[model samples]
Target: MIHHKTKVAVIGLGQWGRNHARIYAGMPNVHLAAVVDVNSADLRGFAHRYKAEAFTDYRKLLGQVDAVSVVVPTNLHFEVASAFLETESHVLVEKPMTATTAEAATLVELARRKNRVLLVGHVERFKPAVRRLAELARKPIFIQARRVRPYDRTRTMDVGVVMDLMIHDIDIVLSLVRGRIVEVGGLAVRVHNSQEDLAGCVAWLLASRVSADKAAEIEVTTPDRVIRLDYLKQRLAIHPFHGEVEDMAIHGDEPLLAELRHFINCVNGEEQPLVSGEDGLQALEVAHRLLQRMSTVAPPVRV
Candidate 1:
């Protein structure tokens, strides 16, 4: 029952944070109160474009806004997000929750103690293709997911590919399947010097920072049918036991916008977050196991 606009801020004016600021400025009941970044030059441009105050330090912008989107690098997530939650502001933190499971658990507990809405930015869960897959794959037995992209120094520099890219599929697969992960395994290679870590797993999951083209594909096996999803195209293909493959009619929306809108709704007491902090922790825990598994193998020597 929000009758007035909610004051919001976007922190870390990197590529993703700028998009959050843009989307929030356009929303009807949200006020883009502030944008924060260490890079003063970029901060001024975003602040001018959105007509919102810009701050070089995030702490100065905290008390002014009712909620904040923390799109900072993965390493800074826990520090920034916990500060906001301590102040009782709702937060929408970008995925992987934090660099470690212990930090994620602490945030989850603090959010509960403060009675705040803490949401994670697992944008894939809002995809029409994934939404449809959730409905159709009622008993998914196995899932195969591939998320590959050309080496981009701007992304995943703070973390490995499993956390940056594959974590999306990990969250989605955990959502579709019923049982806990009893087993896990994988392999990862570092094809570029910018990679923070060369770690990946092989348990039906593959993510790389070495591909020539951008690709995101997932295949799910259920009792009755097999489902395939292309994340970039937002398409879903289903194969029944007796009939030919059928393409699902997907009614898609911009995932980041939908995710942010959901955060606003939660802030307004209209609905619970589609992806909660605990859910993000679950995905992160699985990702850590994958990383731990990959750590056993010796990484290729860089020349």
Candidate 2:
């Protein structure tokens, strides 16, 4: 059987986007067709190293690729991914999907209409620890997640930390709890940039309740025990009320590679996207709720 290689591109050569390019370049049965970024220097470097076409304008590769990873800024996600979808190309857009919930919904509908795969880049879903948590978190009564880090000046500052970081936790909690969010409230403060730099949100689910903290961890409590997952450490520990602490074994892999491979599989018609565009829209909805509340309540902080 002759297998045709899947032509793929990575739009946005920022820190995370470059990793996508590197991984796609090395994957089997995949051709890294192009890399796009406004920064000519970085684009040229990646193109030369990966031996793919380079484009400062993403529209140049519209009809040329089979699939693409939309790693651009939050504001540009809708435009870039929509264009690719219009060209019948599958898209794997990064987390938060788009700057607005409406934009997310549009992408979801567009992908459906075009019969193309629209996968969200919620990379955490690919983690082994997170996978185990999904299996063991049956009937979770309470959940808490913390994803905080020092401000990186180099990263895109177009959106607040809620949409940038907290959205991942929002996606996870929504996926595990699988309940309608009854209410949403949160407080955020802008310290370093125009956008909110720190945020904390609470979401009341029908069967489960969830909140956010100021660090990088997730704790899920059920009727019998509590499962603690450390995001950075990639560890899962379970503590029962009556028994000893039981550490859950996790087989870890580079999450980005796993996510990219899944996208490729979806493009190849071998599997469905684990994180679909609808899933991204759901997360973005919750994020907007929190942001809306915080905007009305939280006061600006002096840096």
Candidate 3:
């Protein structure tokens, strides 16, 4: 018997990109071919650690790898991922797909035209608790998610809280519920930074760069029961209308690792991506609608 390893590259060597590279390097059937970043300093340590070639320009790595993980900022997602797709390499783009629906649509079309596998990094969908919730909630009448984070001025300044944090919840809800969103209404506040830092839609999102605690939780209501998920604790609880609440057993697996393994399987033609480009676009569309709704509602006046 013979074995072949897929060549994988990680672009934009930031926090998430580095993690992607680390996982790919550790995988048995993947060759961590290269790591790309505009910052040579960012490329050096990770490339050396992973024993992969480093390139400052992503274009140089286009034809060199079988697949690439586009872990760049939201704005650069389209440019990087599309380039890889154009070169006929499979791509696993970080969540929110692209900055706009138009860009996302373009990437989806390009991937279809090229017959390349395009996977979106909706990591939460692979979480044990989320998967259990999807199985348990047969008909979700109402879904509420709260993703609050403490002040961290260093991350996600390119987009607001809704895009940064609520998007995960949005993707998960859309996956579980079969109905289209008939309407959306929400409020947002620029509590700390001039940027909008907090939002409340059907789900409440608090991506504050000024908060005191961190939390991630979701609750789903069906006709017969309510399911609660604690993302931080990785737990799921089911409350029936006429019985006591039951704590569901959830396997403690890292969502990102599961996501990457799924991507690898998809690239190998062993399975389809759990989260497709269309799914990412849908979630992005919902996030945009929520933002539009928030824009109409006036923020509270601060003294």
Candidate 4:
């Protein structure tokens, strides 16, 4: 029961990190305490806009903030998140929690030992349609998920498509499926010079570069019906074998905003994190497996 406003800060003022700062600044129960970025020029402007302190190095805000959002690159997740967890500050780290499973496990253990909330920023889990799909997907026999976007060099270069894009569906599929992943395989092609631009597998598919507009959808097959979800449109469709399609009426909200609110709720001890550190670790483990298989065909560059 927090009687006073929670002091919060967002590190890494990239595009998504900027969004975190925006949402935190608007929250009534939270104080946008600080913002951090390597680029001092952009950091100063954002800090002034949000009326929060700016830091070139994130370590300066270690003890000052009650909670922190680690929106840095995937490679920096372990370093940035572990520092705050050790300081007893709750953390909301973006997806692909760390570069390796070992690092992910270390953070999870640190959070447990410190008795602090460690929420992973698997923002798709907060989408209303995805939330509804989790409820309806009781006996999913087959699942297919696709997420693709145009090539962007500004973000996600530290990792390949499997970690950057496919991990979202991997996390979602793990939640939906009751059985363990007994067998896994993958194939990838490098469309971008930096990382594998396209990758495909049995259950989930991901691509970072698309010829046309962006796309995101998940289709699940049950014994009786097929359910399709459009992530960007926030729409759900249920198709029975013999009947007309049923469109589910989903209440829409910004997924990132909902995710941040959940993080704050976990910080206040009012709720548990929907995507825990352990969950993020599991997703990272599976992603590594897929990457291992893909490497046989085309070795990925280590960023």
Candidate 5:
């Protein structure tokens, strides 16, 4: 078997998964072997567009592909991704990795035991501005992140806003800090859905050069600088000894296209995932702690 032309299958061809199908099919090193979804309607265009087989049941495609991209809902993440790993296939699961820390651990251990690659699609890490910021990070002191959506009701029902949105920031922060978490304090409330729609958290680094007094703010301070990322605006600003704000705007582009290509690299032994399964698990761990500390203050049940 030629290792370079790795065949791949995509489970769950919904809004997000469809994009994965497109990129994997188009990329040079990958062969988009198949797409599996419970809904045939969703699989129709995907099969035609990607020149890949479509299946209502993923089990049929199990041994046919070398790798699988599990882009299913958070609830199904554990079941779907674990199935692929059991067959010794590499997995690239979309973020929040799994519904619980235990499930994430399961996938991670399975991948390790099978000697297969397990990557997390924390696509935010692939964003150009975020990529640039990561390149310059040096033991960040404090951090702040804000991710607001206009009530999709797509994922919030399954998990809290902390998982749907904030988890991305959590992943980035954890990857950058690479430090010990001293304390965690948070607040969350259900603005519209039964699950919390809004959440904000503060994590303090135990030993750092940034001023401890500035702990109240979301600023990621370091010994020499204070950087703030405005993901919404695709802008990043850096504070240094000489100046206060050095704003940078990411050029027009899409990052997932880049991320898809990177996955191919991992399969070919060219590179490693920017965010591995363990990295994704850490973010979820932090989120679970936050949700635990501050009970879900949902708007009354509408029976």
Candidate 6:
């Protein structure tokens, strides 16, 4: 058991936030203090089901918990986390840390000053295959990643695919390369709405180099040694460097619960945070670079 107990609250009861509450509520060392959501039905249902307090005002929940997870929209991340941190509560936040780099920096600094554990919710990093691959990653000369969706018209109302989906692969790539991006190029198309649904980006990073990812965006990721991920027919594809590619149809599960377990471990001071604010900021920086470049046809080269 962890040395000290921790009280936690999950703010926002959206689809993603509900998962956060589920995981935290089950952890033995943590207390799922409360869940705050504007929707009365969702708030009541989740609170009763999880045996956590229900409230519409996060501020009210703030005084009642030691740590909180912010699962609201990307735009509200900075505002909500800041409020909780200012009150001396540790925070675990969902990705795209904040809408702006400055806001992300502010939260990072605020958490540091207060000696609070500030963790970002980058769920894919916790995948078993990724954890094993990262251990074996070496200098890779090239990299390519693809993240496609059937079409969730309402999912990305505030951000594009770069932020909404590709950002996951982007963060994974950046983490492995650990390089300074020399230049970035992108191609995106909005398959369903005003925002770009399909995005492809290439980063020329001055990286230390590592082995490439075997599976990206529904593809099975392979490492130098061992057969890690299982790919079903079209669900994921596993490649053999020496043999023909193998295809399988299977669904890869989301690792949200494992991620929250890791966050609680970080808060318990048993291990360092898996996704730090700096990591989130780095991913956001790359995401913004792609979108900014995509916005202009070719901003007449600066003389």
lDDT of each: 0.86, 0.85, 0.85, 0.88, 0.76, 0.72
Q: After TM-score superposition, what is the CA distance of residue 195 in candidate 6 from its true location, in Å?
A: 1.9
Most accurate candidate by TM-score? 3
| Number of the top-ranking candidate, with lDDT as the measure | 4
Task: Tell me the tens digit of each residue's lDDT in model 5 across 20-91.
Answer: 988888777788989899965757676987788888998897767899999888999999899889988889
RMSD of 5: 5.9
How much is the lDDT of residue 281 in candidate 6?
A: 88
Backbone N/Cα/C clashes per model: 4, 0, 1, 0, 2, 12
TM-score, each model?
0.94, 0.92, 0.94, 0.94, 0.88, 0.82
User: Which segments of model 2 are wrong by more than 4 Å?
Assistant: 204-215, 295-303
Give per-residue CA lDDT, model 4, range 1-303, as digits (tens).
647899999999888999999999998999999999997566787799989998999999887889999999888999999999999999999988999999999999999999999999999999999999988888999999888887765654777788888999999998888568887788787765657768888666655564367998999999899999999888899999889999976886788989999999999999998999999999999888888877434545689
lDDT of 1 by residue, 148-183 (tens): 887765663777778888899899988888468887
lDDT of 3 at 171: 91
RMSD of 6: 6.8
Task: Residues 53-91, candidate 6: write the lDDT tens digits.
Answer: 888989886556789999998999999999998888989
Candidate 6: count of backbone clashes, pairs at least 3 residues apart or interchain: 12
Off by over 4 Å in 3: 40-42, 203-209, 296-303
The 10 consecutive residues of candidate 1 with the worst lDDT sum are 193-202
The true-versus-predicted C-alpha distance at residue 45 of model 2, in Å, is: 2.7
116 Cα displacement, candidate 6 (Å) = 1.0
Candidate 3 TM-score over all chains jointly: 0.94
lDDT of 5: 0.76
Off by over 4 Å in 5: 1-4, 40-42, 153-156, 204-219, 300-303
